[model samples]
Target: MARPPLRNDLIEEITTRVLDGRLAAGARVNEVHLARELSVSRTPLREALIGLAGRGLLTAEPGRGFLVPPFDPDEARRLYTLLAELEALALRWTSPLELAGLPDAVDAVADEMVAALERGADLSEVDDRWHALLLSRCPNPHLLRLIEQTKPLLKRYEWCYFGGVPRAGESIGEHRRIAAALREGDLSAASAMLVRNWVSTVAFLRKDNGDQCASE
Candidate 1:
C-alpha cells in the first residue's frame, strides 16, 4: 500500500483544494471521501484537518469534524486592512539600495498581467508575483512570514476580484503606477500606492457584493 502523505504535503494539498474552490466555502470536509481519494487512511487526514482548523482556514465544531469557512466580507475587510499595513510597513523597511532595481523587474511582471488580461486569462498569480517582487527586499523574516500566513486567507477573494476583466485592467494600471513611483526613487509614494492597491481590492469586493445583493 502507498504510504500516507506527510503532514506538510497533506496540508498543502488540502489548502490547494480550499483556495481553488474545489472544496468550496461552507462545505463540510468529508474525511472518508478525502482519505480515499488521497489514497491515505483517515487518521493522517484528520490530523491535517485539525491543523488547518488551527490556522483559521477550517472550522471544527462539535460532531461536525472540519468545515471550510464561509467567505465573509467583514473578515475580508479586516484581512485586507491588516495586509495593507503589513506590506506598507515592509516597503518602509526595505532599503533604498535594495529597491534600486525593483522598477524594471516590477514592470516586467505588470506587462505579463496586461497580456494575460487581453487574452482573458487569470491575472491573480501574476499580480501576486508583482506584489512579491515589490516587497522582495524586505529584511525582516518575521514580518514576511506574517504577510505570507495572512495572504492565503485573502486568496479566494482575490480570485473573485480578478475574474472581472475590467478589474484586472485597473489592477495593472495600479501596478504600473507603483513601479513608476519606485523608478523615481520615491519609496513613500510606492508604499502609499501599495496600500491603495489593497484597499481598492476591498472596496471592489464590497461593491460587487452589494451589486449582487441588489440584483437578487
Candidate 2:
C-alpha cells in the first residue's frame, strides 16, 4: 500500500510504538513487516524509514534492513537541550512577534489534552499533536529543523511515559504553565517552564528507561 506524505503524524505513530517498547528497540522493520504491522504497503513504509532515519530514530545500514536505533543518553540530552535553546530563543530573542494565531492553535491541542486527562486518556497522541503545534510556530527555519529532527526522539520518550507504562502526571501542570506563558508572551516564564519541564521529566524517566548517563 502507498502511504501519503510520510507525514509527521505517521512517523510519530511508528516512533511512539518503538520508543514505548511496544515494537522493541533493535527490532527489525523491513518493508513487509511494517507494511503488515501498519496496514500499509512497502512504499509508505520505505518513506517512513527514510524519514525516521533522517530524524535519527532509525538507522539504515548497508546490506541490512532498518532497525530501531538504540537509545543514547548523551544524544538524547543533547537533542533535548538543543530543542530547549531553540525554543527559548524563539520565545525570548524574537522581537515580540505577535502571537495572533498561536493561542487558538495552542488551545486546540491543550483542550484535547485536558480531555484526555479528564477521561484518563492515553496521552501519547495528544502529546505528539500538542508539541507539533507548539514547535511549528517557531519563527526560524533552523529552529524548526532542530525541532523536526528531535520530535521522533522526544516522541519516543513521551510514548514511553504516556503509554501503558503508567507514568505519573506531574508534567501535565508544567505543560499548562508553558501554555500560559506563551499566551501571555512571557518569554522568561516560557523558557523557565520549558527547562523545568524537560529536566524534571528526564529525571523521572532516568531510573529504568535506560542507562543513567553522565549527561543528566
Best by lDDT, which number?
Answer: 1
Could you give candidate 1's per-residue lDDT for residues 28-138 as a string of tens digits? 999999999898888889999998888788999898888888877677788889999999999999998999889999999999998888888777789889989889999
lDDT of each: 0.84, 0.65
CA displacement after TM-score superposition, residue 197 of candidate 2 (Å)? 1.6
Question: How well does each candidate superpose onto the true structure, as a TM-score?
Answer: 0.89, 0.65
- Predicted candidate 2 versus true structure: per-residue lDDT over 1-216, tens digit per residue: 565544656687777677667666666665676677667667767887788887778888877888776656556666667776666666554454654356567667767777787787677678767666666655688777776666667655443232232333566667777877777877688778877766665554454555532122
54 in model 1: Cα distance from truth in Å?
1.9
Q: What is the lDDT of residue 86 in candidate 1?
A: 99
Q: Which candidate is the best by TM-score?
A: 1
After superposing candidate 2, which stretches have Cα over 4 Å from the reference?
1-23, 31-51, 93-97, 100-112, 162-169, 182-185, 211-216
Model 2 worst lDDT run, 10 consecutive residues: 159-168
